[model samples]
Target: MKKSDINQYGLKPVPDPKGNSTGKAAGKAISRVVITIVSLFFATLFIIGIFMFSYIMSLRGEEIDIDLHSLNLDYTSFIYVNDESGNPVEYKSLYGGESNRIWVDYQDIPQYMKDAMVAIEDKRFWEHNGVDWWRTLGAASNLLSSGGSFGGSTITQQLIKNLTGESDVSISRKLKEIFRAENLEKKYTKEEILECYLNVVNFGSGCKGVQAAANLYFGKDIKDCSLAECAAIAGITQNPYAYSPMNFPDQNKERQQIVLSEMYNQEKITKEEYDQAMSESENMNFVFQEATETGADDTINNWYIDTMIQDVVSDLQSELGYTKEDAQNMIYYGGLKIYSAMDSSAQEMAENAVANDRNLNSDPDMQCGVYMMDYSGRVLAIVGSSDEKEGNMWFNYATDAKRQPGSSFKPIAAYAPAIDKGIINYSSIVQDEPIPNYFDDGTAGPNNYDHQFRGPVTVQYALQQSYNPPAVRVYQQLGPQNAYNFLTQKLGFTSLVGGGVDDSNLGVAIGGVHEGVTVKEMTAAFQIFGNGGQYNEPYTYYYVEDHDGNVILDNRDNISTQAIKSSTATIMQKLLTTVVTQGTGTGAGVTGWQIYGKTGTTDIDDNSYFVGGSPYAVIGVWTGYQNPSRLRNTNASKSVFQSLMGAYLNTKQLKQFTTDSSVTSAVYCTQSGNLAGPGCPTATGWYERSNMPSECTQHQNTNTTSSRSEEEEESSSSNTSSSESSSSSSSSSSSSSSSSSASSSSSSSAA
Candidate 1:
């Protein structure tokens, strides 16, 4: 058969072993089969590459146009005060804004942090360009097996997604992320890409970057992060809320351990370091940054900003017709400049006074609210609690909490109205005897703080001693509806419940309103006396300006209304001054400062108050509990008041309360509410000169003569009764005469 002839199977004959044609032909057959298979494989690969390219291109419509520069970090809006030189001297952030983030450079990042992130997130991070194909395949397998989605995002790909806002979980979105990530890797170095990723990732609880996370979790810089802290932070990238050390410490510890184990298995950390990190992770303590209800960053240890933000939002809504959300956005992102009336020096002093008080510092449940304002009604300093670290309860007790004013409410609710109506003066006598069923509910009427009452006491004596009965008598004389009107309308305390004739009873005189008063309201009410009856509305921020310097709101123009007659305020001031000098509020006295204030303790001692101030400032301090538990001592509020006011007074010059021309000083018999007579005991008092009372009838000429005759007869009879008793009886007569002489000597002592 020919060399190319068919063998038996194909009807062609086989060639000999030495023939080159046979060997060459066999080799060509094998080559043809191999080439065909190779061509088929290349065709399949080309089809897949084309499909992927098309899918990636489909996601490039509007997303590709995003500007990376727009994602840069921004600072939150703040309440700021300028110095004498017109430069920002002090400021505090209005927390819970969108930009509560801080950026850190790649060089400043710790090595352990980078290693842990790479180990847990993408094992082939260094080997791949941007997308880890192996991780993607594994993630796909995990999704299929687990019947749920899984993330395979490399650090660079995450940066692309964050920067471009392509966060949807679709195949097209993944392709877009992969495409953009490759482009990012080409445009920047690996270090730059990693740095941007770290800075833009969310660490939850309103922390938006690694630096903020470091500070919020450890209260330290990113470069100072230990291995365990780094592992914990790295674990948060997977699920920040679920793995938060503050919210879920145990789950966070578990995730942290996984990161440490991965680091050890990958040889990114030594065995000893891995073991130490694992141990520390189990006992990690997180010191979260101070944040508001909205989870925005705030100045550490400064809680006043929370209240300041609330006021800003409300003012914005009322003045500009903006919704709450719109107002917050405007304040946070509109670059508005807030000028606050807060005196930084005074605020620091007030905060320190409360924070450092041993009584306040020792008890966490005991809370204090202090509001200090200047005579112009600008809030100078306010603190909600002694410890700013107290949980997330941002209720600003100074302005938001309605606590009983106790005896502090007396001057506003009772005396001011009584004096304004010419019904009583500081020297006018009021029966101090117990009132019967004053509430009409069979409850006994008010009593003196000492639970003992003198038969008849001057108004000054009653107020100085904080005797509850006198205040209740004055309230009854003024009527409930009238006192409520004076408090709500005249003094701008609109928070008091009920109105008109159906208002609260005599208890209102001692802070027994439906809803009590806030420290801010009480302070403003007291300022009425200091400002000579002019009620200046208490406000914090003076003005706010937008980014373009257009004034959005300006409160520099003072808003003052006449809350009481100047003479009435002067009389009230005189009465309260005696309180500080020789009354229940003597603990608040400062030498040469003419300090005037009142101390108040509620019936059950649940609330205590001291509202007093110098001529330069008015301050109100309250000590109480949220649920109203009796304090260990009623004098607790007094100590806080002394500390705060003393610190404030030390910074100012001595000033005195201005006297009104309509007011005149006089001597009157406290027993009869009449002018001083020859035999009547007298007390110095303030009265409207035109409204002075009549001469004393309790010690008229005939009665005085009769009383003297009776006393003389009695003395003679006692002396004649017994010689042995005569020496003792003569001593008694001399004592009686000395007492009468002493009673006639002074005019201003308490009767």
Candidate 2:
């Protein structure tokens, strides 16, 4: 033996004297290799076992206890409105209160549906303990081959996910799901798990559970679902949004075929049944449910409920810090009790008033909206449209529709702000003559509705008659930016058009806004007059309680902010009263009640509006074609207002408007808007004591032409009125010709 061949042990190296040492060495090396491989295999298995045990232990502390019996498949929240006695009356469901949502037990579900679900979702659902290892391995293989994740979740595992809300697709989430599924299987029977899965799974478009899906898609109960319908519903479980029959009909039909094929391959359905189902699915005419804009099922014909649901969801998100999805889920499934200020009698009256109006009912395309609210801004009633047809039922014209308010917006955008700023009083004279193009360009100025000018008139008469130029003058005096801020910020008119001061032109005073106004907004704004200048944000629900009877929102004493001086509101209310008595709004007057409001008829008669109310209730009525067409009758809204407000006022005691001490009244010349002289015609005028104007100066015989008072002169008054008078100074001219020439000159100045 050589030194190099000696063992490292520093001992004499021995060899097999038989010359087979190499073979023997090789054989020993192979044996050692085998032993090492076996050891590594066992070590790997031990590590995996430890890891699984730790993972299982990690999930053991997680709260997985769920009250299965307390699960309410038939639970639905309700919206309660006040009855005549002021007690809460159940009006409708918070979630399709009138919709038919059937909850059937596992036995009641059609066998075809069960078969289809098992075949498409998990073929070995019946035999598996809680997971199907074979299917999981196949899924992993498929994932690797397709470079995408695949679902291998058994029905029990899905049930566990639904019950525990552990829906994340991570390793820990998968492990927890497995543990929960096993525990669930141990605690409940296979049939019970299936039942829970069918009842808890989410379908598309806010539909939950197999029963809801069956009704929403087929308009039938689960037990009555045909083979094709069953396959369609079962397929939707994979990707509800992608395979929704209403949204993706072609894709849903394709998925349905896959479900039918799976059932046939699994021998769950006969070949003949599969072929028939496939054929039917190819030409399926799904009776899909009509959903509101918020994606709730809209089987019931109530736009108010739809808007209320949206508002409730918004309140939940803003007031309670819940996500949009969470809030909607709570509304539909949390079984909350919502109390609203909706007066059922008022709602019925509003609806009937619009529906039965001869002007609105004569034209199918004509739509009318009526909204009523108390002085505190609690919505009493809302009628979105006169007709509730498929084409128009979803549009909430009262709150959602934005139409030009015409003169109805004058009080809010102009008079209220001007009065608040002490810039004008009811007795302040505004020249009702043609205004020149104040924009300094070649644009036409505003004209009265009849294209006729009435000389100097009091602010009371200007508002009552809906004189366009007077409002523009007042708006200019208040400053366009100041008026815009007051309207958009102070009064909460969010829908006004234009972004900057440049867009806030004189037209805004006359409702020539980019997106005019809604009936609800107008009504809410008008309520400020009745509420002594306090603006309470209009709301439907007074309070809301969660499923656990915890009060989430209590809006009974909602905060009210001062929009204007109480004296200003009082003076404006007095002026509005005269509108119903002697102005364009006389038709809206109810017997024995002092009604006040302004009438609005837009350019081309596109929209008609009459917004007014007594001290008890403020109501707004709007009548127009949805597509901005010419309306033959501009006073149709007045009629509707008269009908609804008449009924509403008749039910309550005639209440008088409370006068604020700061508001004062004085006798002034109606035509001159000044303190009455011995020979001047006079009318009663209300004014804010601080803003009352000086005694008559413009109408005095000697002072008529001696530089009219600056406040009484129109902001855009040119020498046009004087120039036209000079041309007609000839006595030889016929009286009618002189009148006609003066009118023509005024019209030319306006243009």
Q: Give the number of the best model, judged by lDDT.
A: 2
Model 1, residue 731: C-alpha shift (Å): 49
Tens digit per residue, CA lDDT, model 2, 1-751? 7655676556666654677988889999999999999999999999999998987898865436785656644347878887777888887664433243345688998889888888998899999888898977776787679955446779987776555543334567666766777777777888887777887765664566778787667777788989999999989877665677865788889999999988998998898888888888878977765433224444453555656676787898788766554465566666788897777778778878887888777777888888888888788888887775332124677888988777777888789989888888887889877556433332334656556778777787677666777887888788777877887777777776343432366666666565567888888888878879988888888899977789998888888999998998898888888667766676788999878887776655767888898879899888888788777666678889999999988888767889999878887765566766644556677876766766775456753433333223432342222111101011111111111111111111111
lDDT of 1: 0.70
> Model 1 reaches what TM-score against the true structure?
0.62
lDDT of 1 by residue, 1-751 (tens): 7545446556546756689888899999999999999999999999999987786567544234444445533235556886656676547654324446666778899999888888998777787888888878887888789965557878887676555433345666666777777766666677776777787776654456778788878888889999999998989877665676755678888999999999999999998998888788767878875433224334442445555556777888888766453465555445678887777788888888888877776667888898999888788888887656532224567777887676778888889888899888877778877666443334444544445567677787777766666777887788776887788788888776443222345556666654567888898889988888899988888888876788888888978999889998888888888777666675667666877888766655667788887888889998878788767655656677778778878877776788999888887775676777766766677888898888887776644522323223223433222110000000011110111110111011010
Clashing pairs in 2: 93-97
Cα-based TM-score, every candidate: 0.62, 0.68
**Model 1, C-alpha of 11: deviation from truth (Å):** 99
lDDT of 2 at 647: 90
RMSD, model 1, all Cα superposed? Answer: 23.1
Backbone clash tally for model 2? 1
Which candidate leads in TM-score? Answer: 2
